[model samples]
Target: MARFRSICNTLEVLFFLIFSAWSLGNRGSEAKDTLLAGEKLRDGENLVSAHKLFEVKFINLENSQNRYLAILYLFGYDGRAVWIANRDNPLMDSSGVLSINRKGNLVLTSGKGNSTIINSEEPAMGGNTSATILDSGNLILRDGERILWQSSDYLSDYTLYLQNDTTLGTETTREKGRQLLDFGHSAKRKLWLQITVLVLIIMSAFLIAFIICRLKSRYCDSGGNNEKNEENDTASSRLQLNKFSDIEAAYKNNNASEQKLCGNKDSELPLFSFSSIESATNNFSTTNKLGEGGFGPVYKGKLVGGQEIAVKRLSKMSRQGLEQFKNEFTLICKLQHRNLVRLLGCCIEGDELILIYEYMPNKGLDSFLFDPMKRALLDWRTRVSIIEGIAQGLLYLHKYSRLKIIHRDLKTSNVLLDCDMNPKISDFGTARVFGQNESQANTSRIIGTFGYMSPEYAMDGLFSEKSDVFSFGVMMLEIVSGRKNNGFYQTDSDLNLLGYAWDLRNQEKILELMDSTLVDSCSTNEFEFIRYVHVGFLCVQQSAADRPTMSEVVSMLSNETTSLPSPKQPAFTIGKSNIGVESSLSTGQESVNDVTISVMNGR
Candidate 1:
C-alpha cells in the first residue's frame, strides 16, 4: 500500500510539470494585439483586438488571386473586411507584409517589392510607434497614446455592420429561428408601405395648397384692376422675352463651342434655375459668403439632397464682363480632369449669372500655405505630394487633356485643396484653349496675379507653355520657402522671394531658403529638398525657351535619374525701385489702360 501511494504522488507531480510547460509555450506563441516598429505582420499572421472582436491580416477577395491587407470583424460575420490598405494596388500573390518604417510611416509591401504609404500625413518621429486593431474595427497606428493614423478617417467602400451581441452561438440561434425572422421582415415591409402612403398623402396636400394659392392670386388679379393687370402682364411678357432671348443666344453659342470641342451631343451641362440657387445660398446670406474674388462674391451653399456646392456669383461692378463669364462657362464644361475643379451646373436668370462647383472643404492652398499656424501642418511629404499633384495637373492641361488649356491664373489662391489635402487647380476664368499647332499667343488684356506672371507674358504679352512653367516655378519656390512672391521685399537687399532664392543659389546656400518648419521633417532628405529647389529654378528661367516644358518638369520630379539642365537667371527680380512702384498701386486693382492687367495680392 505504501509503494502504490508513492507511485500515485510521482504521477501527479509529473502531470503538473507537463501542464505548466504547455501553458507557457502556448502563451509565447499566441496571437499578438499590437504590431511594434520593426516587427512585421506577415501574410499568414494577424493582429487581433483585445476582446478578439477585430483582426488585421492579409486577405484575397472571392475568385481573385490578388491579395490585400485589410481589417476585418472576427466574430458573428466570418471575417468581413471593413478597410483595405492597398485596394487600388493589390498584391499579385499571397506574399505581403505590413510594418511601421523608421520614418514613422505605416507601409505595406507586396511580394513584387512595391510599397504604399497608408498614412496621409507622415507622422513626426519620436517614441515607439505601433499599430493596433481596435474593438471598433479601426486599425490605428500610434506613437505611444497619440494616434498618428486611423483607418476610420479613410473609409473604404465596404460597409461595416456592427452588432450588439457578437457571438457565434447567438448568430446560429437567430438563423435557426426562420419563422420569427420572416415575421420581422414582414413587419418591416408593412412599415415601409405605411411610410410610402404617408409620403404620398403629404405630397398631395402640398399640391392642393399650391393650386389654392394660384387660384387665390388669379381671383384677386381678376377682381382688383383689369387695366393694371394688363399693363403688368405686357411688361412681364417683354421682360421674359428678353430673358429667354439672352438665354437662347448663350445656349446656341455654347452648343457651337461644345460641338467644335467635345462633339458629344449627349454631354449637356445642367442648367440650374436662379430661384434654386437663391434658395441654396439662403438669398446670398452674408454668412454664406466665402470671399470676394476679382470676378465676384463666392458663397457656400447646400442643395436639397445635402450636396455642398460653391456658388460664384458675378458682380455687376466687376471688371470681368459677360464675355469673360461665357468664356469660363464654355471652356470649363468641356474640360474634365481629376485635378481640375468639377463644375456642377450654372444659373443664368435675368441679370444674375452664377456658376456652381463641387465645394472644397479645405478651401484654397493659400489658406494653409501662407497661414502662420496652418503652414506647419503641411510637412515635407505633403508639400512634395502637392507639388507632384500640381505638376501632373499642369501636365494634363498642357499635354494629356482633349483640349490643350493654359491656366493663365495659376497662383496659390487658385489652387484649392480637398478634404484629403489633394490639390485641385481652380479659377479657370482666365484660362485659354490652345490649338493643336499653336505654341504661343499674345493678349492685350493680361489677367493674372502679378508675381505669378512670366516675363514674356508680363512684358510683351506673349504667353505660352513656358510662361505657365515660370508661374509654376514661382509657386514651387513659394511652397518650399512658405513665403509669397508678391509684396515680399527683403529690408536689406530689397529683393523679393524669387530674387532671394536666386541669390541663395549663387552663394550655394539655397537650403536657407527652405521653410523653417520643414527642417526637422526633411533633415534626412536634404538632397531631395535641394533637387526640388533646382527644378524650381529651372522652371523660372528668364528665357521662355530655357524653361522646361510641363512634361519634362513632371519627369524631372518623378524620376530621380533624370539629369536636369542648368537654369539661367530668372526674370522680374524687382528691387527697391520696382518695389516702390508696385507698392504704390492698390492691391487687387486692374490697370486702367488699353493693356488691362488684373493684379492679385497675397491674401
Candidate 2:
C-alpha cells in the first residue's frame, strides 16, 4: 500500500509540472495591445490590436533572410505588411527586441548591441508614455490624451484603413452589437449546440447527394453517357478554337495598324493588357497626363496595389513610326545600367502602342537646370554628379554594354531625375548598335536634335561614338553656363554658346560662364568646375579624332591626377552667320528650337 501511494504521488507531481509549463507557454504566446515603459517585446511576441484587425511584430519577409519590425493586417491569411519600422536597416537575426527605453522613446534593439530609436524627436515623458497598437492599424505613443507619435503620419508602404461606415450605425455594426450582447454562458452553449447541429445536417446532406451521384454514374447506360461525353469534348474544342481565332485577330489588327509583336522573341518582356493600363491611368485623364514628347504623350499612373508607373503612349500624329518604337523597346529592355531609365513593360493592342517605365518623380534635368526659380536647387555638387552620371552612362553604351550603342540623340531633356536627384539616361529611339570591330557608320538619314549634332554627322553623314561625345559636351556647357546653346549668342559677336565658351577659356574668364545661381557653391569647388569646362571643350573639338573617347573622359573626370591635353577650336564656332549658311547649304535643314529632326540628307 505504501509503494502504490508513493507511485501515485510521483505521477501527480509530474502532471502538475507539465500543466504549469503549458500554461506559462500559452500566456507567453498571447499578444498584448499595449507596450509600457521598461517592458520588452521579444522576437516571438506580438502586439495585437483590441479588435484583432492588425498585429505588430518582427517578421521575415518572403524569400528574404533579413527580419523587420512591421505592422500587418491580421484578417487576411497573407498578412500583408502595411508599414515597416526598419525597412532600410533590417536585423540579420531573429534576436530583436522592441521596447520603450528609460527615455520614453520606442527603440528597436538587436542582439548585436545596435539600437534604433524610432521616435527620436519626441520629448521624454518618463514612465507615463505608453505605446498602443490601434484597431485602425496605427501604432501610437501617447501619455493620456496627448499623442507624441503615430504611424499613420508616416506612410512607407500601401494604404490600408477600416471604413468609418462600419462604426456609424451600419448593418455590420448592428450585427456585431447583437453578437456581443448574446454572450451569456447558457446562451453561448445553446448557440454552439445549434451551430453543431446545423453543420452536421449540411454535411450529411452533401454526403447523401455525393453517394447518389456516384451510384448513378456507375450504373448509368453506357451509350447515353458516351454521347454526352462526346458533346462536351466538342464544346471544349470549339471554345479553344474561338480563343485562338481571337488571338489571331488581335495579331492581324496589330500588324495592320502598327508594329507587330516580335513573335515570342521578346517573350521575357511583359505585355500589359489595355484595360489594366486604362484603369491605372484613369482613362488617361488630362490630370494624369505628365507631358508630351517626341514619342507621344506620357502620363503618371498608379497600379491597383498603389505602385506608381509612367506610361508612354505613342500618339497617332507622332513622327516616330514602327522602327523607332521597336528600336526603343528592344534596346532598352536588354540594356541594364544604374544611370539608365528602367523599362517595365509594353502594350500593343489594336492601334494602341504604349511603353511603361519606372516613374521619375523629379522629371527631366532641363526642368531644374533651365527654370530660373529651380536653377538654384542644382548646386555645384549636384551638377557635378549629373555630369559624372551622364558620362558613366555614355561609357556604358559605348564600351561596357553587351552591344556597342551610339546614342544619336543625347540632350538634357532626355536625362531623367529620380527622387534622390540621380540622373538616368532615357530615350533610345534613335540609338544604333555597332559590330564588335565597327567604330563608325554612315547614314543619310540624320535623326537628332539640331544644336547637338556633330559636324561630321551633320555635313557628311558620318556618325560614330565621337558624335555622342560632341552632344554631351554641348550639354555640359549648357549645364555650367545656364544658357541654351542655340538661343544664346555673344552680345558684340554673333558667336553662339560654343564660340563664347572658347573665348572665355582663352581669356581665362571661365568663371564668367558659370551660372549666377551656382555662385555660392562654385566658390569652394572652382577648380573642379574649370576642369569640367576643359573636358567639355576637349569633347567638342573641330576634328572628331581630336575628341577624347568616352572612357578617357570618364577617367579624366574621376581621377584628378590625370593630365588633360589642350583643346582645339570646336566646330560651328566660326560665327553663327557663316556656320548657319554652310549647314543650310550642306544638309538643307535649318535649326529650329532644338527639335529632333527625323529626316535630313547629307551633302
Candidate 3:
C-alpha cells in the first residue's frame, strides 16, 4: 500500500508540472501586465495588456555613466521616459530578480542577501501590497488597496514631473503634491546577486532539458526548432527598427515607450500640478479663452485670490510647441523691461505647455489699430506716443538688454497695450538672441507674418536689428494712416497701404496720408504729425543700411526739433509685384482690394 501511494504522488507532481508549463505556453501574451516582473519579463518584450501607457525595461540614462530600472511613458509624447524605480541601486545584469517578497514588501534581492526593500508600514502578510498600473505611466504600491507609494508621486528624473493642480508663478509644494525620489546610497549589491541567480536558473533549466532530450531525441528536435523560430522573430523585430525614420515611431509600434531611460534630475524649472491649472481655468472653459495663436489657445484665468492672468496653452497639434516652451521659458525668465511683457510663470505638466502673462485690459495693439471704428479713438498724439513707445522697446532689444535680441517677427499684433494704452512689446515666440557682435542669421525654415517682414528676411532668410526696424516702419505707416499695410486702398490707385503712403509722400501730398479720424479728433499741428510719417518712411527704406537703428529711430522720433532725412521708395509697389491678400477699403462691400494683402519675395 505504501509503494502504491508513492507512485500515485509522483504521478500527481508530474501532471501538475506539465499543466503549469502548458498554461504558460498556450495562454497567449494578451494577458501580460507591464508592471509584473518574473517569468513574463523578457528582453525587448512589451507587455501591452497590463498598462497600455507604460513599458517594463532597462535603459541607459541620457548622458550618464549607469543604467537604471525604469518604466517608460507611452502616451501623447515624442517618446519621453518617466518614473524610475530602483533608480540609484540598479541591477548590474539582466538576471536581477524583482518581486513581492513573502512579507508583502516590494523586494529586490540578488545572491548573498543583497537586497532592497520598498516597504509599506502596514503591509498585510503576503497579499498586503498590490501593484496597480496607472494611465499616467505610474506603478503604485497599495497596502490592502490603500496606496503606500507610487512612482509618479516621486520624481527623480527631470522628465518625470508630476501632474497636479497648482497655480503658476507660486512656489510649489513638495509633499503636498509630489516629491522627487533621490538616487542615494541603498541596497545595490543584493540586486547584482539576484542577476547572477537568474542566470543560474536559466542555465539549470537548459541543463535539465538537455538531459531529457538525450532520453527523447525526436521530442528535443522539435523543441530546438521552436527556439530557432523565436530567434527569427527577434531578428525580424530588430529589422523593423531600422525601417523607421525616428525613434518615436519605432517605440510606439513595439509599445516600448514606457521604458524609463534615466534617473538623473537635470531640469531646473519647478513642476506645476495639472489640477491647479485645470481648476484655475475652470476646466478649460470656452468663456475663459481670449484667442488662439500658432501654438494653441489663450485663456484668461483668475487664480485663488482673483489675480488675473493670460495663459497661452500650446495645442497638441503644435509641432513646435515643446521647442517654443523651452525657448520662451529660458529667454523670458532672464529678460526684464517696462516695454516688454512680463512673464509670470510657465506650466509644463503632461502635454500642456502654458505661459502665464500679466493681463492687458486693452488687449493687443492690432485689435485697435486695424479696426476702422477703433482707429478713430486714437488721435494723432496717441498714435505718435505709441510709435515712440515701440521704438524704445526695440532699442532695448537691440542694445540695452544683457543679451542682444532680434525681434524677427515684430508686428502690431504682437504689441500689447496696457490699461493706460501704453504699448508693450509681447510674444517672444519667434524672437532669437545673438551673441555679442553676431549681426545676422539664416534658417531654411522661414517663420513670421507676411507684409511686416523686410525684403531681406522674407526672401533670403537674413535677419538683424534692421529687420525689426523695417517691421516697425510698416507699423509706423499703419498707425499714421490708420490702415493695414497689406490691405490699404484708394479709389484712384491700386497701391497697398504702404504703397499708397509712399506714392502720396513721393508726390508731396503728405496731408492726404493722415488718418481722417486723427484730423477730426486732434488739435495737434498737422506739420509735426506729418514729420512722424517722414520718420516712418526713413525707417522703412528697402536697404537695411538706409533704415535707422532703434537708437537713431528713437532719437529721430523723440526730438521734434531734428529735421529727418529724405525717405526712399519702400519695397513691393503695386506695379512691381502683387503681394499678400488684397482687401477693399469699402464698408459692407467686398472688392478686389479687400482681398487679404499678401507680400511675396521682393526684388
Residue lDDT tens for model 2, 1-603: 222222333344334433432332244324588998878889989998754657899998767989999888664325767668888789999999998876667889998885755764657543487888865567887653335677754211111111123353356655554554454445646745775575566556556665665565555545475557645665765654443343333333332211111111112356789999999999999999988766778899998889899999987766564456767776776466789898877787656778899999999998999999998999989999999999999998997664689999999988999999999999898899986569889998888876788989877789999999999999999999888776677779988899999998889999999999999988988898999999999999989999999989999999988999999998878555865534554444332333667677876
Comparing 2 with 3 on TM-score, the higher-scoring candidate is: 2
Arrange candidates, best lDDT first: 2, 1, 3
TM-score of 3: 0.53
Clashes of 3: 35
Return model 3's CA RMSD, one decimal.
Answer: 22.0
Q: Taking the tens digit of each residue's C-alpha lDDT, what string does model 3 give over 437-521?
A: 5888876545566678787776676889999999999899888877787655555776777788888877889888887887765
TM-score of each: 0.58, 0.56, 0.53
Residue 13, candidate 2: alpha-carbon lDDT: 39
Whole-model lDDT values for every prediction? 0.73, 0.74, 0.62
Clashing pairs in 1: none
Worst ten-residue run, lDDT, model 3?
582-591
Please name the candidate that would achieve the greatest TM-score relative to the true structure: 1
Name the regions of candidate 1 deviating beyond 4 angstroms. 1-250, 253-267, 319-321, 579-588, 591-596, 599-603
Cα RMSDs, all models? 22.0, 19.5, 22.0
